[model samples]
Target: MNNPNQFIPTPYTNSVDSGNFTWSAPSNIALVKYWGKREPQIPANPSISFTLNKCKTITTLSFERKRHGGFSFDLLFEGQPKESFKPKILKFFERIESYLPFLTDFHFTIDTRNTFPHSSGIASSASGMAALSMTLMSVERLLNPEMTDDFFYQKASFLARLGSGSACRSIKGNLVVWGEHEDIPQSSDLFGVEFPFEAHEVFQNYRDTILIVEEGQKSVSSTVGHDLMNGNPFSEARFAQARTNLTRLKQILIDGDLKSFVALVESEALSLHAVMLTSNPYYILMKPNTLAIIEKIRKFRSDTNVPICFTLDAGANVHVLYPDEYKGVIKTFIDGVLSLFCEGGKYIEDKIGNGSELLTVNS
Candidate 1:
């Protein structure tokens, strides 16, 4: 077999019965916005987010050590094998190995599943990678219990970023800020820090109604999204809008005001998509239902006089945000919208969720 401690051209599967490790990572919706990544690898642009309650992804990492050989890992998505799902997995392992070089030789088997629908534009990548980060940390603890939270976070967060730019936020709880520039102390790899205010205390009055229609995947990924945004003439415009949204949203979050929060959230989502509209060849991640949902939202907001905001990530799904107190009312509204639009208004409902951890670790 190949030497794992050293470099091996091919990946290998573990033979020993690897212990199980599980963790739940939340799907984060960017409030401040991260239109561009500075590093793309770890992302250069600073970002902020809210940890959703309902949307989550769980991950498990097990290891089977060989007496004298290299090891490999298998990824399972929702119990199905994740063959060639992403090259980032290997990159992630490599990043971790740099810190704990001693683990370079072990074999790995990873299994991940999302509580929310996958490819439904629900920030699956963020939660998936965050779950992986926490799972890996659990494994590390099992092998070496002396590691500290700071150490684990620093290393694991970086590792998670290798998988997906937003995954780093998933490792954090409540609210998190991705790396940002100085002149402001808000930016840094800080995970698990509660927002200055209580999430439930402040956001107890919000809701999100998502409409999942098949507008088809974009030719560009978020990485590409940032790339195009960087060169597009509207790049500076997007930046200005994002800055304003961030400044205003921060105040709303602190003030614990639901109305202002929803407005800012909806506006930011629109601004992000608008940039994609003017991209070089034209890229729009929206289905007819998406537009319909927007119209419905406008109508609903006007009818109820309650502010319900809608946001979309890189995917073609629409996420509706409202007060927690309005879930029942929102659910009814969502059902009505879906019923009226028939199959076009399909979508999965989700709330904020906790970040990653290990549920099981089989030895």
Candidate 2:
């Protein structure tokens, strides 16, 4: 229950000061999935992910002193006011209020936008929550100038996890692991850490082209999915299997074992949906085209000897992962074959990113 990066600080700057903070956080596709959770948004199983580019959320927080000491905020999506998002934003602030006690002293104007559509099935919550966390932390940095960059992200990751479990991973770039695993050093249940070992160059520039099979909200929310795991018959076995996979994956990444990487990545993706399918009141998130895309990816890999593979989130979209060397061939395959299966022939061409970024007013 001990969190090493707990935030407890007295204000070091004037409470009457006003400023704006902006940050862009990327959405990550879990290479090893974190399906269920425990208290305080701790992962039931360990997860590792590839930080994505292009698909991200940018959040800006402009703060001003409140006349009376109480919290207030306006939530804006893109550029317009969004009432539906206000409740979730309010709830997130409430959860993290203890970590940032100065919230009640100011009124905030928050503006957020996503590069990809919410209907695209990318983990928007992961990117969105991380952006908000980083923006808030930037404010904290202004108040207390002594905070280090490393500690800033560590606390940002911890705060983001409290809002959404997968969000912690979005705070770091390249590959990140979230959960307390013995095989991984410095791993914790409270926040995500950048994968500690050196990654092979092959994976360093890997591309992720998201195929949107269903462009709408999912039937079963991730919250409900995690709740079902409480009584899941295979919960214990799944957790054990995840631990084993994390250990194997770490070695594969370091050794540049592409074949093993493909097998493990594909298997983990299927296993995630499999658990959902076998739950008590089973629900299937995959659409008809989802299976078709997977089949095509397998056939393409077999025929061309490319290292392309697919992974899925808690929704029906497909994340096609491959190396940079095969970019031309992959794009051709997408345009000629895969594009036909896409919803309105739309798929995002994004690569593994250098992690998230902060955009200041001066910058």
Q: Which candidate is the best by TM-score?
A: 2
lDDT of each: 0.66, 0.89
TM-score of each: 0.84, 0.97
Give one digit per residue, the lDDT tens place, for model 2 in 1-363: 247436666656634368888899999999999988877787899999999988999999899877787569999999999999988888888888888888887899999999999888888999999999998888888777788998899899999998889999999888999999998899988889999999999999999999988898899999999988888899888889899999999999999999999999999999999899889899999989999999999999999999999999988889999999999999999989998899999999999986679888521
Cα RMSD for predicted model 1: 5.8
Span of ten consecutive residues with least summed lDDT in model 2:
1-10
- Per-candidate clash tally: 29, 0
Candidate 1, 1-363: lDDT as tens digits? 111222211232222345767788878877767776655254434566777767888877777765555336787888888787646687666655654443655677788888776655577778888888777666666555655676666556655766777777777666766654332343553222334444446464344555666534455787778777667888877766665565566667767777777777777778778888888866887667678878888899889976677777765667777777777877888887753552455666666655565566566
- State how far residue 186 of model 1 sits from its true place (Å): 5.1
Candidate 1: segments with Cα more than 4 A from true spot:
1-18, 40-44, 67-71, 181-186, 189-194, 197-200, 215-217, 342-345
Off by over 4 Å in 2: 1-5, 10-16
